[model samples]
Target: MARTYSLNTEAAKEANNGGKRINETGKYSGKIIAAFYEKNQKGTESVNIMFVSESGQECGPLNLYTHNSSGEELAGYKMLNALMACAKVQGLTWQDTPIDLYDYDEQKVVTKTKECAVELQGKRIGLVLQQEEYQKNNGDIGQRMVIAAPFEADTELMAVEILSRISQPQALGNYMAFIAKNPVRRLKNSQASQPAPRQAENPDPYDDDIPF
Candidate 1:
């Protein structure tokens, strides 16, 4: 029998859960639409990078907490490596010196920070989403930070273009709001398709993104 293969748009839609275009494990192929620095009440600083699906759904404000108040690395190196990979894919230059997370906080530092800002804004990437149970701002068990990874060869290319060019801000906001309202349930692996058990209490952020 001859082999037949085709993109299943309907299945894809179902897997995406009417949100940003994503794969079964919730892998997103989109560009970084927004990036900003956020400081928690405890004075811990982190950068928030948001990726919008090609369909204009906001998939994440992926947090990269570079340092604590004591100046310690907290998942900053991983994020830097991902950024370097993204730069390599786009043919951008990067320095071999130590990465300064504070540089990312500013709009200057042209060669390093500025370039990263420009490249990440509207540039395509492959974001990996890992679901975890957390307490929402409203005291609901529906909050989780959808993590992301850098672009890779096997990354699914959905919404091949950027979302800003195709969607209005209001529409994008509505999509994000919808996502915020709906709790992200854990997805089973492709092979099993069995449901995973939910935890009764909040825990640390799930570290399940594919190693880069």
Candidate 2:
């Protein structure tokens, strides 16, 4: 399939790689628009999920790696269950996906399947959030609003003790304190301060005067 450019649209355009929404610490609600099974180099299997809120705030491409390479049974499995329960996401439909292929003729990489890995898109999710601030590669601080809390799309239940154990909201007192003590490191830029070498000039590359 070809691509279409939405040059003149009032849509929520995605921020280029390191972009984030400036939000506050509170309850957030959204739906899971993307989810698919993924595996790591160590053979750990996971489902990567991403969310978008009503006001266009995004949370993740967060990974829930339950199938561990180290084979620790029941570790991190409960979190995955919470997501399914809240979203009412039942009946997983997994398929044989092709992850290693390139189409040179189309000049693109393609995976042909019904939603490819597993169709878990458009499922609702809720979170208790905090706009955790951190510095960036270029010495500028940027806000990253990570979504997905596994709470119902209506409540964070932040105060209840039992709620904390079950729901797993982002910024409970314990987690927030830990974060304050050890702030998240800035995003690493692979091409950090790399030289941008200019291409060799064609002398008059933009000269439109064709003589012939």
Candidate 3:
């Protein structure tokens, strides 16, 4: 059976993510379930991505795009590039293709389409999840685990400590070793600064009360 893909153009579910927050902040091995490019009416371009562990769980349909610029590239593109680099080092190749985006709201078969690095679908990669705060409708600080970094999936996922510098993932080409120097701060979401040892081998394994 083919996996169903939703563009999720609606404002993300904000109330405990509509009670679907089953993951926590930590590292997880997964694949790029989907990637797409979109330009809004404001003429802002974005690359949206989704991730999941084939064995269990899912995250995102998160937009990796931002107006935060650094030199010739946007920070979001660098994150996407790092994901691509991770997969490429694992022998995944790429090509341009179209993605069928479904509109599940109106009982529709298909309501939208877009071209992207379609070849990236299902490519293995690693994600470093970090919790961030968002204001709830009740003015409470809600937490969500976000993809903070992408590393090569083929490496020992347990030993993945140092996420590469935005300028370095393509060069280091592996998860075990890093660029070994100061990180170039290109984006607010990711800076090559290493993470502390994971409290669990796998972060949230889906409890009924998962924060994110």
Candidate 4:
């Protein structure tokens, strides 16, 4: 017996693949859409931020070693200071108050005060995108983009006026063509990337330990 099925070509051609697209390495102004903390082997905290470029393309899973949960004075202290300073550029403010009763006068009644942490989402920032290349254990060349934390005087800052300029959508047409050509692969990839009910691990994990 032969089984027949109907094919809806137009519908099938709109599927999405599981491969997360990375932005081309370059300086750009972007908005942080998501952020979270991931711990390393030594229990150090790294801030992971997902950015969407002005072009409206998702570009990052940018990792910055900005804090130490252990608080033992690790290497990232200076970087953390810079990050805190940069918070001001994003319209964030810091509030400080004396911790001792002796230091506080009648005007200040509280013993302690605290500033809000950087709220990255919906904030725009300028970044220097750098590309690093390494040979994998399998002898494949692996390339990745990273934020070149700019602290030097020579670091170029994108002008404030231009930061608000609109960017054309970068991938819409090509993406449509990609789905048209690889519809079945896209469908399979998407399905495989979703987590199953009892599975704890990611179904389609990338090779690198660091989330791009």
Candidate 5:
């Protein structure tokens, strides 16, 4: 049976935005599960081959007409190719097993995905997969897979350490530091940046004597 795909407005928006970012260097790791093709419906042209995320979470039906490039239209297949390449590099294979999509809501999936992304990001020192975008593709692909690590500093260092334990270490300390500094700044900025006050809180006078 074909998998059902569903997404609320937010997921659809994010997926659509991610799809628009695909470029020649294959910098965009997000996949397009569906494509648009011309079909006659009620004597008018209509969309065909709508891609959907396997989990049916935030993703909505993706129309193919939105894609501007033939290569971009092949996003799903390209992501699969990248995943297979990564597996091969790590001496892994998918001969008899089926691939499973990572569920962002699940703790195990979250940990595994973060770990993989962090390692690759650390090694590369200059790439970051839009994580929500990655999640959408994860659902679309419906398989256990991996990608090159993201370039976010903390993720980079974590990834480097993990990969090093399994293989050889490289000099990414500078890159890691560069990535780390900005996040720290952002954290501080976020703390300092507060929204303006709204109405004052209403105190519950009747509960003043309640037990702690």
Candidate 6:
């Protein structure tokens, strides 16, 4: 499909120093919405808003950076935002009115997430939200993050696109399982590497059976 938002050659050149990535090529000056998904060691998932594009091309996959504290990646959000920004810039709106979420199955397990609907030159189209983020802030306290992604789309074309671009379920599951198993080994290794505790310098003072 033809993209509504065309990458600004000049801006992209400046941004990438002449080498532009695929997703960046579609991003232009517009509001780029992005969502992030974070999976902790215990398989708990969190979503968070990663960015709202101000100018220039989208960050592409490279935009997904791993935060030092949480070690979560944000690339998917970058790409989605870029695509949406491009669609808006192109003056496209959905004709069929795509649903906000669509159901999909991975290995017979169904899932869903937010989706984007747009019409380009009278052609109805939709982009599945592969990921999203919901941000939260507490009073003089701290900020929290949540992340989610669409696992399905309404059309076969969109579904194919998503499948080709996103990671497969089985692969992701195996990887997560692998990570969960390694922590135990790591804990054991860490404990084994530490020095034993020093013995008490003085014996129990309460001992009364001393040989005279």
lDDT of 3: 0.52
Backbone collisions counted per model: 0, 2, 1, 0, 16, 15
Residues 63-130, candidate 5, lDDT per residue (tens digit)? 11323333233333333222222222232221221222336577342211111221121121222221
Ordered from best to worst lDDT, the candidate numbers read 3, 2, 1, 4, 6, 5
Tens-place lDDT per residue, model 6, 175-208, is: 2344333321122233422222221122221234
Worst-scoring 10-residue span by lDDT in model 3? 178-187
Worst 10 residues of 1 by lDDT: 157-166
Q: What Cα-based lDDT does every candidate model obtain?
A: 0.46, 0.50, 0.52, 0.42, 0.27, 0.29
Question: Model 4: per-residue lDDT, tens digit, 1-212?
Answer: 89887986534543332123443445455565554455788777665556655655555556667557666554344333343323323333333322222133566434433222346445566554555454567977566666543221122221211122213422223333433443222122344322211211221122233121
State which candidate, 1 or 4, has the greater TM-score: 1
Please, what are the lDDT tens digits per residue for candidate 1 over residues 134-183? 55568655536555334432333212111112222232233334444443
Per-candidate TM vs. native? 0.46, 0.48, 0.51, 0.42, 0.20, 0.19
Residue pairs of candidate 3 with colliding backbone atoms: 23-212
- Give the best candidate by lDDT: 3
Residue 26, model 2, lDDT: 51
TM-score leaderboard ranking:
3, 2, 1, 4, 5, 6
- The runs of at least 3 residues in candidate 5 whose Cα sits more than 4 Å from the true structure, single-residue gaps closed, are 1-69, 72-96, 99-170, 184-212
For model 4, the superposed segments whose C-alpha errors exceed 4 Å read 1-22, 67-84, 87-118, 135-139, 150-212
Q: TM-score: which candidate is best?
A: 3
| Cα TM-score of candidate 6 | 0.19
Give the least accurate 10-residue stretch of model 2, judged by summed lDDT: 197-206
lDDT accuracy of residue 176 in candidate 3: 21
Colliding pairs, model 2: 59-146, 59-147
